[model samples]
Target: MNFFEQQDRARRNSGRLLILMVLAVLSLITLTSLALGVVWQLFGQSHSSLWLASDGAIGLLPSWRLVGVVSLAVIAVVLLGSVYKSLQLSRGGQAVAERLGGRLINLAPQSLEEQRLLNVVEEMALASGTPVPPVYVLDDAGINAFAAGLTPQDAVIGITRGAISLLSREELQGVIAHEFSHIFHGDMRLNTRLVAVLHGILLLGLIGGFLLRGSSRASSRSSRNNSAAAIIAVGGTLWLLGYAGTFFGSLIKAAVSRQREFLADASAVQFTRNPQGIAGALQKIGGNLYGSQLRAGHAAEFSHMYFAAGISRALDGMLATHPPLDERIRRVTPEWDGRYPHVASLSLVPADASADQRAVAQGWDQALAAGFSPASATAAIASIGEPSAAHLQQAHQLLDELHPALRQAAHHGSGAQALLYGLLLAPVAGLREQQMQLLQPLLNADLMSHLQALEQPLRQLPGNQRLTLLDLAMPALKQLGTEQAATLCAVMARLIRADGKVELLEWTLLRIVERNLAPSRRLSGHFHLLELADEVQVLLSFLARAGSILPEQAQAALAQAAVELPYTGLNLLPAAQCDLKALEAALKRLNQLQPLQKPRLLKAMARCIEHDGRIEVAEAELLRAVADLLDCPLPPLLNTTSAAQVG
Candidate 1:
């Protein structure tokens, strides 16, 4: 599926969820109204002498106004609860991990298992063209993992201890691939929203518990029989209603979560080109005594987010968030004979020297292969969110090719800062000297030395490798204090300006880093394409100019793109008018377009870049950068010869 189309579908699902939530709320309102009606009838019956003289209608039918008031109160309670929980979780995936008692893995892993896990996560990030997310390990001894965040930038991957200790490296990679699929599919946002909505439904149960306790204490303290009885009745009613809410909430979670698990499982197989890897993990989960169960008290709250059902079901699997293990395995490994595989204790496996050398050689070979054609460019666009085995192989090879020191540097805060600064240093001696001069005042002497030392290696790196290193450095760079981050941004801005010209690569690198590091830079809205046509035009013009060397070529690219967009009167802006500042502004606005609109924009972009019937490395890099800026995880554009091409 096209990345934008998937995003649009996710948005639609979110809308459907909202509609379902409204229906649920209405159901709760009706239940509450009925309970209140019974309470009113009982109250009248208890005061029969006073009610006997009045109209007997009071006992038969409850007051309409009272029902109305109760409905309003229930709606208010549920909405307020959901909003409060959503705001709390706005801190992002880190918050969810911490909530479940997960410990963040150190950047420099101390254990072989931790190191292996980190490597797999890094490769997945690189292959998917997303920034490397922080990894968290739950103490729970279960074979489960999850991805959580509102967006890829803030995303985190969480794995159970059992997954690390019980599964082989390939199995672990499969699990990680599944989690990354969730991240790519935009499932985390929906999962978080589900968490918030469910919390709202569960609030009634909490309130009931509080009321019951209060009533019990009051009855013991005084002889207020009538008041005590009244409290007991109300609390008892709410307690039942709370459970009713939970029942429906669990159903909603189950409905939304199960199918996604199947998709992710298939995606994992597609990604690794090894169904047995994921199937083996599943079989092990089935055979192991623990069977993917979590000990955390909050496990049930986010059970649907897990790679498998993280808790045992007492309802005969009715409330299970994931599909049956055997069934899932059957889908991945169709030849399975319905047998569970016995998992042994995990052992550390040493890296193969020959394989490493071969991968590194292969990486360079692939880099120098023929440049992409128009068909390849279109294929690359389609490959977004659907990374194949080739992408995984490329990721592994790229990681192997990176200098060990640079890779290690990407894992730590201080080293990551130096790496970023080093990448920003210009190749020209005069500009490099000026950048160093600007940095000397802001950084300590040790940091300055590190930056200076990394320049030569950074200069020798390939374009894709450079981007991969930047992606790897994201989690570590995120550890910087606000002041330090701001300084880094300032230094980068100065370096980009020192040469008096902003190369496309330089601008893209700066944009990627800044957009990720600074949360305020994230644009949040859902406007239609027509509503943001001017912003789209500006962005398309900048993209066209970035892809072509000549003004006429740029104009031609823009013309190709304009035909795809529905808007008329769109034309290429002059090179002076389409500067980095203008492009940045345009991106900020385009980021606000609705999910469906983004696909159209991307299609147009592909058309613009492939107008010359060739996709140069610079053009491909720019396209990937633009895709990343738009929150789309585009796989690398490998050289291909095909008849079909993207519009």
Candidate 2:
């Protein structure tokens, strides 16, 4: 499936999960109620004879009121538990990684392994046109990794120490590609939701355990043996029922997770275009003693999120989160010959030593001269979730072209803060002075000094490079304290306003940073394309005007876009009505468009910008900004002279 299909499928899977979870809960309630009724008949029916005497049908059944209350209680507990866990995880991917004993990998690498991992992740991000997500290291001797987060902005990649130390560079890339598949296919959000919902179902088991423990302690002290027996019976019953619920809940989780793993494995091969890389990793896992088993205690909770299962299982093997190891390897590498490679510890070899420096430099030079074409635009959009070898080459060359100082600045939190400030600084003398004056009071002297030092380098940066730097700095910027982040947002807005007009690049930078760093303020609404026509028109007009230098040009661009619309008579909104504020509001609503609707909207946008038969730097930046708002990562539109860009 393509990117849009994957998104739509993930949404449908979420609905399927809900239906299954409800059924599990209902089953638990029924079993628990029946158990309660049996207990009542055995103990509470004092006046009637013991063995089904005068009590008749009434004795065998639970009270309707009791059943109602129990059902309500079960529903409330499950919903509340799910919501609480979801909220906790909503703090972002970092929370989930840390909860599972992952240590954040510093951007400034202290070790060769760290540097190699960062480079791989950066290349993948650039290739796929995504912000570079933070990487975390789990201190475990296991070959596994996972992606986590509610959205791309907060997404994080996690790897175990064993995977880094044991796997070859190619093998590691394959594994990272697998996790990226999860990020690109919208699996991370669903994986997190599964974690939350399972927590809710498991809460019943936890409560039962607590009740049994409390009753056992009370029984030890009580002289009223009969009352003590009753408590123990009730506790045991609840415990049994809770465990029974968890059994089926896990089945549901296993069923949903298993199929996705196979698809991700296939996508990994497709993404890297190297089946042997992934197939080799699996073979090593089969041969190695650890075989992807994590040492972290919480590994079991996120088993499905991993590149491979993080914990060992026995009977649960039937409900495993990943397919059997041999089966996976065979699928990826059909000529496996039924033999696993001898796993051995890896030497500390430099990962990219074999990379061709000359070829990489040439790639960048060629990409610079290549202008955007309609075909290139389409390929760039389609390549959202699927990065190819060319994209990888471009990403590599792009990294090489970036100034070392600017690149290094993107790795650290303090430096990243200064980098952001540098991007927002105005070129005009008056506006620059105004912005500096406003910033001096709000920020400390050290940060201001850093920003001033980086100003020249940042100014020399190209439009595309500036965006890549912003993408690189996202993880570090997200590390800022809440107050600091809020201050940064306010200061950025102030600086933008200080210029007396909103430049497209300035506004794009602000939107990208805030969307990634600040808490998500996604406008929630149902997808209704017809209802959103005016908002769509406003946005298209903004794009049309932003791309053209003259009123007639803008009108011409608008006309091109109108051809793609389902209805006629859509005209360009007035320039006054297409300001940044209006554009922002329009985007918030447009963002709620259905996954299928997004392609049409994006196609219209492409028509609007390419109407003059060229895409300028400013127009490309605006396109990237809109894509970012829609949670889509558009690759840099290479300057191609003609179409046939896709291989």
Candidate 3:
């Protein structure tokens, strides 16, 4: 599905959920209120009251006042507690996104292209007018990445070490762009909501634990009376209910999370205007050693959001949070071969290559960063395009022309050096000597020294830049294609083979290199708010110039889509814009248009009418005029209808 359809669906879903939450709270309150009333009646209507009630002076007792006060206190507590919990859940969502982003920012994959991941994310955010999101690194030796957040202002883009090392710039752009699609079109909000809803469900379990513990302590302090026994029994029941809530909450999280992933993948391709990059990335995942299994502790909770499954060993149809890896590959590759090559058999690089070879690898990396084909250079410049400053703003045009080549290069270039070098050189270098001393007992004397030599320069470089160096060094081993990439990956496996061997940071960096060089991998990129709107404007401008509809009619129709209002507002020339004559001709021509061509045409027209913040009354009238002529109802496009219509 396209972004607009996904966005509309998400918004509708959110509204429905909010309504449900309100109903749930209200129902709870109503039930509680009624129970309180019943309990008061049972206690307040005592024998003394019955005896006095027959008198003319008989009236409601003051006992009801005590019950009323208690009822008000209960209501206040529930409302206040629920509100506080909601806010806490929101903060936790932000925390998850930020924590992940911080790790990615540390990846600094030494390659010029790979280093751009951070910059690209920032650019997208600025373009979209949202705050720049945090970035995180997944230290998996697999080609994958993902974006997660509750909103544009609080989102994160995470990449596997494999992705930074394996995919070229274009492919990386495709991946990042895919994530941005989730960010811009309201998918992030849904993700955040899932986190919150799940948290709310699990809250009971946490409370149950607290209650059970508290009751045990209380029982120790109190006499073994019937009251204590009853309290403990109630606590035990609440604990069981809490666990039940946790089970349902997990299911809910998995269910809602899976569908949006498919939509985000489609959107990523749309945003980058390239299927190959993401498709390539998926292919690498299936072919790689570690695949996409993330080693991070939090992998389970974030599985559904990963570009590929984080910890899954094999794809299971129902349990899967992502589409089957093979299916995902097929969607982009349009080719099928289930076999994947092993990483060790592919390359000739010795885990213990000589000093000279290591230096050569470094040189290759810097050259790759600097090197560029004329065609790609031309493509990058052309991607920017001629700004229609006279017709469209420069900011808008800039947003329209996102290039894939730059994305690929950035993911694998030398420029990434500066970013990584700044973050990790110290901790890594400090540990190197200590590691070397320990490894002396296990390895051949020469192998230990060779590794030690690689460490100093490697440590001298920053995290991202060092990562680029590894990418540069690894290509010699990867050029055998699949086998070579695999072989080089094995060298990485061997290097970390010893006890007290690889530090977390070291392993993370190595995995990053492995993923970058993976044979089947593609890349990804994304756009921000300014970019989205600018592109929308370009589409509208193009449609306004298309024939069959007058500029005014085109403009009106476009405005309807943008405002998400009924077409009745854009008072069109009833017979021309919407009548059978108008539609038949357009539909006939539309069939001749390529996939997405018609949507672009429609979106472009929408742009013209949406120049103002609100849809004009005249625009609404024009739309109705067109709809009436066509004998079509101008209805608010619901989620069910939106998919069919947009598709």
Tell me the whole-model lDDT of each prediction, alpha carbons only.
0.80, 0.79, 0.45
Cα deviation of 78, candidate 2, in Å: 1.6
Q: Give me the displacement of residue 443 in model 1, in angstroms.
A: 1.3
Q: Give the Cα RMSD of candidate 1.
A: 3.9
Least well predicted 10-residue stretch by lDDT in candidate 2: 357-366
Model 2 clashing residue pairs (backbone): 370-639, 370-640, 371-639, 371-640, 372-639
For 127-240, candidate 3 gives per-residue lDDT tens digits of 222333456765556666766655443356778767766665556766776777666566666665655554554454465577678777887887765455555554454455
Encode model 1's per-residue lDDT on 1-647: one tens digit a residue: 65566677788888899999889888888887778667756755331122233545433444567678888888888888899998888868988999999887747665667777888888888877789998999987678898998888888999988888788778888999999889888899999999999888778777878888999888888876777767777788877897789888898889889988998999899888899889988998987778898898888888899999888778847788898898999999889999887755433323322212232333232233345777666666667788777777777767887876678788888788899888878878887888888788888977887777777667777765777898899988877887888888888877777778777887888888887877552344588888888778788888888777898998899888887788767788876777888888888888888766776787789999999988877778888899888777777775442222122
How far off is residue 251 in model 3, in Å? 2.6
**Highest-scoring model, lDDT:** 1
What lDDT score is found at residue 326 in candidate 3?
73
Q: TM-score rank, highest first?
A: 2, 1, 3
Tell me the lDDT of model 2 at 26. 92
**Which stretches in model 3 have alpha-carbon errors above 4 Å?**
19-94, 104-116, 119-134, 138-144, 166-171, 217-228, 272-276, 287-303, 311-320, 341-647
Error of 2 at 518 (Å): 2.0
lDDT of 2 by residue, 1-647 (tens): 87777887888888888888888899888887777667756776332222354747433667776678778888888889899998889877898899998887756565677777888888888877899999998877768899999888888999987787777778888998888889988899888888898888778778777877987888888867666666677678877877777777777778888888898888888778889888988888887777888888788888888999888777667668888988998899888898887776544323342332232222222133334665566677877777676676677767888877778788888789999888988877787778888888888888888888888878777766777898888878988899888888888888888868778888888888887887574443358678798898889989988877798888899888877777777787898998888999988888887776777788888888889777766677678778878877777775542123334
Off by over 4 Å in 2: 45-59, 346-370, 429-434, 521-525, 639-647
lDDT, residue 521, model 1: 27
